[model samples]
Target chain A: MRYELYYWPEIPGRGEFIRLALEAGGADYIDVGNRSEEQGWGIAAIETFLGGEVTDFPPFAPPFLKAGELVISHVANILQYLGPRLGLWPGDEANRLWAHGLQLTIADFTAEAHDLHHPLGPGLYYEDQQEEAARRARQFISERLPKFLGYFERVLIDNPAGERHLVGETLTTVDLSLFHVVEGLRYALPNAMAEAEQEAPRVIALHDRVRDIPRIAEYLASDRRQPFSEEGLFRHYPELDSDG
Target chain B: MRYELYYWPEIPGRGEFIRLALEAGGADYIDVGNRSEEQGWGIAAIETFLGGEVTDFPPFAPPFLKAGELVISHVANILQYLGPRLGLWPGDEANRLWAHGLQLTIADFTAEAHDLHHPLGPGLYYEDQQEEAARRARQFISERLPKFLGYFERVLIDNPAGERHLVGETLTTVDLSLFHVVEGLRYALPNAMAEAEQEAPRVIALHDRVRDIPRIAEYLASDRRQPFSEEGLFRHYPELDSDG
Candidate 1:
């Protein structure tokens, strides 16, 4: 069965995590929000689910997946549900849970990355909270960034299966999500990541490997892939980035 | 099999969410972090997993549950695993996924609540970022708090099962977690929750219902339950709270 992914059309936000998994898993799915008015699907399609019509299981936010009768929201939840179905999971309950934990960590890291540019919450624009955002970015670059990247680097190094993958001997959605996170960090905070990546060589290698995955490579080069922008989660405002 | 839960011993932070589920589910478990040194457990027990001995499946942070050989991290993941086993879940695939989705939203809400005092991230203290905390608290109380509470309130009212539970006809882990969120809000932002609760009567009623659950009532009165305090997630800082 084909899946319907509902997210904001303009940016490669959290939805991109699921998109990478869908592409890497080689599943048949449509990015609903990206479709034009002629194709009969757009932001309105996403709003319909959030517009109270589907009251029983209303998604609180975008980046929800509609698979048959299932509407899964939250990036980690969607990835966990899609992982096994798309053959992106390790196929064991234990490893699946482990991968989900890593995905959750990545989610937390991504939230922090987003916060670096909007430290006062999304209710206000980044311009309104530039001072606070700059301070947050400094602390984030000096502390949180290293802590999370180092943790993933350790996870990769300590993987009993080997250092190549995060969970098992094969690829899982966690790897895909991590790859996006690394790309996001590099794109959003080039100077900081250039320094940070030095200590996380293994994570960088895994990111490179994920990029080389034929399906992900094609999707990255295709029109379906949206570019990162200030409107998305990992925004690059040079003022909120540092190399310390 | 008895489950072993590992988290920070003092505060009823994220770990309390998992604790409530274990108690409500009537599962036999050990709160490893809360145990005494004489009992051969404490913070060190939690550190063991983080200390790198468990190479194959290391948890990024805690409130991790060890059930037999499976180690589940993240409050939602752990509850989702235990919900079916302990009969706290709705016992259907769709409703279970819905419940998990709600739990994930609660997780996001909880993080925001924590951030009200730590808007600069946990690298600094509330005293260090009191001004930013005040700004964040205003946004949280005026905006984020109501958005989340209203969402849950709608979820409760929209439940096809009835206006009782967040997921289905019976109490699920989502209800338990939501109850804690309400309690935390009321404790941390009494002035704000008093006004916000007006718009979320159904959610408030659900919290009351959770409080009356026989198992949960007994647990609340027992020493096993910790009190909300300044050191925990829901710190009662009057300066950072407002009715509007």
Candidate 2:
């Protein structure tokens, strides 16, 4: 079945996690919001489903993937559903669960990355909360960025199967998500990422390796790969980057 | 099999979600962090597991549930595993996935609640970030509190099975988690919750119903139900509360 991916046409945000999985897995899907309302695939479809009582399982937000009768939201949950279907997840249940756990942790990391720019709340403009964002960015660059990246490094180092992959010998959805996390950080805090990479070489390497995967490499170069901007989860603000 | 749940002893936090599921399902479990070192179930065990490479799937934080060979982490993932074993989750795959997506949404809500007080970073004490927390608490109480609670109200309103439960006419983990969310909100923001509850009558009613579930009612009164404190996920700060 062709998947209908519903998300804001603009920001990569959480949808990027699912987009990367779909692209890397070579799955057939349509970016619904990118299409016209006449085609019956638009933001209104998402807004309608969200605002009206259309489905028994309603998504709290966008970046939801619809497969046949099932509509799965939440990056980790969506990936968990698509992982095995696309042959991206391991066969074993425990490792699959581990992979899901890793993705959930990545979700937490992603939210924190967003908060680096929107420290007050999403409703307020970055300018309105620049003072708060400045202080929050410091803790993020100095403490959180390393803690999250280092934890991934340690996971890579401790993987019983191997360090090449987060879950097993083969690539899983978590690897792709972590790859995006690396890209997001580098985009948002290049100077800090340069320093953080020293401690998280494995994490960096995994990010590098994921970039070279044929399908992923092609996807990265293609128009499908959205550029990081101020509107996305990871935004490049020179003031927020740390030299230390 | 008896499960050993590893989480911070002081706070109900994320662990409470799993605890409610286990308690309501009548499953046997040991709160590892709350136990004495002499019992081989202490905070040291959790620290060792996180710091050292013991399991292939080592948890980044506590509130991981160890069920025989499986070491499940992340509140949603841990509960997904226990849901079936404890009979707290729905039998069907679709309903189970819905419960999971709902739980993930709850996870996001819970993080926003925690961030209201720790907007700067978890590394800094709440007192150090008092000014930033003040700004965030305003947004959280005014905007996020209603948005999240309203979303749950809609979910309950839309549930085809019945509004009594979050999923197909049975109390799933999401229901218990939502119960805790409402309880936490009420304890943390009594005035705001009272105001928000008016708009989310179904959500409030579901919370009330989950509380009165025989096993849950007993657990609430028992010492097993940790008291809400400043150190917990839902902390009571008079200044943070809004009369509106």
Q: Write the per-residue lDDT of candidate 1 for residues B171-239, one digit (tens) a residue.
A: 888999999999998899989999999999999899999999999999999999988999899999999
Residue B46's C-alpha lDDT in candidate 2?
92
Off by over 4 Å in 2: none
The numbered model that scores best in DockQ is 1
RMSD of 1: 1.2
lDDT score at residue B11, model 2, on the 0-100 scale: 78
DockQ of 1: 0.84
lDDT of each: 0.90, 0.88
Fnat, model by model in order, equals 0.82, 0.78
- TM-scores of all models? 0.98, 0.98
Query: Candidate 2: deviation at residue B5, Å?
Result: 0.6
